[model samples]
Target: MLLAALVATTALTACGLPRSGPNRNELLAGVEQTAGAPFAIPVDDNVARITAYEPPLTFPAAFRNAGVLGPDTINAGDTLGLTIYENVNEGLLAGQGQNFAVLDTVQVDGAGFIFVPYAGRIRAAGNTPEALRQIITAQLETQTPEPQVQVRRLAGDGATVAIMGDVGGQGVYPIERPTRTLAAMLARAGGISNEPETALVTVIRGNTEGTAWLNDLYTDPSLDIALRDGDRIVVKQDDRTYIALGATGGQSRIPFGKPVVSALDAIAQAGGLNTNLADPRGVFIMRNESPEIANALLGRNDLVGAQRIVYIIDLTQPNGMFFAREFLIRDGDTVYVTQAPYVQWQKTLSAITGPVGTAGSVNNALN
Candidate 1:
């Protein structure tokens, strides 16, 4: 009878047990598809395969591997200067006293073609000034004897790139010989005004857009793509952040203190774990990973959409500290530390023995 009473009393003490979060065992046991359970992975050295791709600060293929290109291609809206020299015996474009006719400030129409007096309407865009010069000479030779022609391209709105945000200068700059590439154009604009580590460089080219870390423009050779006419570049300051929860010393949305933050760094930034309440063996980082990166991490291709993943870092295991230091903490990740297993037992014991001791003290006083 006493054993039954003790069991019932102990079970009652455990009812509705308060917890900061699920312990290691409960977290592992709670995986159910119907309940929308997240996949729990143990952090280790094996995760290094996809480490660099976690935050995915890289330019797309469209902005890679392009060699240095010359900026001489004519486009619509460019201004041109033309000079025509005709034979003195019979000058068609030039008057009898003048041997040459100068036509300046000629604008290429919206259809990428320019109209010359004797050459008629000819396509100018997609052709260099020298190429257009030869076409004009060929057209004038039919009517004028020994027609000599020269075409010069002037600085105009057609060959320019607009740079803005976090740069030393925010304006549209012409793409001349020195400012043909992205690196050169950035220098022409006075470079990035923010910290290189946390800055982002995004390029918008027509319908395509790509972005990378500002440092990558110099570090990675492939990322310094050639600038095209009408390209728009923007440099943005870092705004990525993460959240800390559970038994950590502090719980809040914490900014990534640096450009790159490891798991150890994030834990320290969150004021370290709560020694009295935290279970070091059950530290977790919860995140929603993209399908592409999730596939690479999980070694499967069937998964789609943002995957809910909870990564555990057991500090008590061998080399666990090393793994934690190596693992990177991405933006929006939740750092959680479950409560120690013995904490519940201590609470239950205090709850069951407290009233009994009070009643005994009262009985002794009355006797």
Candidate 2:
């Protein structure tokens, strides 16, 4: 009788404790009666309410305001193709013909100056091809009558951006023009090595930096911000994932195939709950919320000490499926489904039946 009582007590204890996660029923019950405790929100009526909550990340505002598009400006180490024209009849650089023209290719020196025949060394860097043409013409007109100049950029590596990380091609990509965008540079680098949904782009503009999902940059027009010279773009594969445990087809950490993953999707990705053993009322998403979100949900700040939150969803109810479809599962969240109480009874019954069957078989063999 004592053994039977002990067995019954053990079974009851198992039923009281959640099979997947820690038994937080007391904490949940406390919050249900009062609001000052740690939050254990049921996903029934509050799914839509918490949808407005954002992750605590300060996305920098330097990504906006695409600078005005301008012609390709010269940079130091650039090769400039200069075509100079002069009137031979009265020009210092006069040739055999009445009209004199000279085509010369010059490299901008370390000091960002290019040497001309009579203009000496002119500052070629920071000026566009047309701007350099005007400067050369102004200097030549002083000595050579009717000197006309045209400048063209041959090649420049300093005006380019560096692309590294998880891209198919990692190298220096030229800015080409002033209006070159982040997406344009990504294209020039052969896109990313992974799917857009599973990749993110980080733009390192000097000390300031910004990150956006590759899918967002492609879909959201505003997120496809402009790229700057000397900027380093890295296409990193997102290793973000959620862990699925307990009575589910899969219990390992699962990577998100899409940018946003819902509770229903998470369950489906885990091969749905283990139908035979899963407890319909014990589906949960466990995660630590930021302090701001915890305070907002609990309605009081000082009372709740920690931001650890557990969201429960009962799959047996009709409304549960609807709520689960809308409840988003964030990165690093733990999705767990508890085993049903009846499954424990099945285990006890099998244990008892195995002994009884063995005794009956031995007695029959003796008879």
Q: Clash totals for all models, in order?
A: 0, 0
Name the runs in model 1 displaced over 4 angstroms: 1-36, 47-57, 65-67, 257-260, 275-277, 289-307, 340-367
Q: What is the RMSD, in Å, between candidate 2 and the native fold over all Cα?
A: 4.1
Candidate 1 per-residue lDDT, tens place, 1-367, comes to: 9889977887888776677778878877875444788887788887744754544667678667655555678888889999999976658878668999999999998889999987899999989888998999999999988888988887556777899999999999977788878888898999889787888889998998888887788988788888877899998988889998888889999988567888888989998989888899988888888888778888899999999988889999998898889889888889988888888777787887898899999999999
**In model 1, what are the clashing residue pairs, if there are any?**
none
How many residue pairs in model 1 have overlapping backbones?
A: 0
Best prediction by TM-score: 2
Superposed Cα deviation of residue 262, candidate 2 (Å): 1.1
lDDT of 2 by residue, 153-206 (tens): 888654678999988899888777633788877888887887777787888888
What RMSD, rounded to one decimal, does every model reach? Answer: 4.7, 4.1
Tell me the lDDT of candidate 2: 0.76
lDDT of 2 at 261: 84
Clashing pairs in 2: none
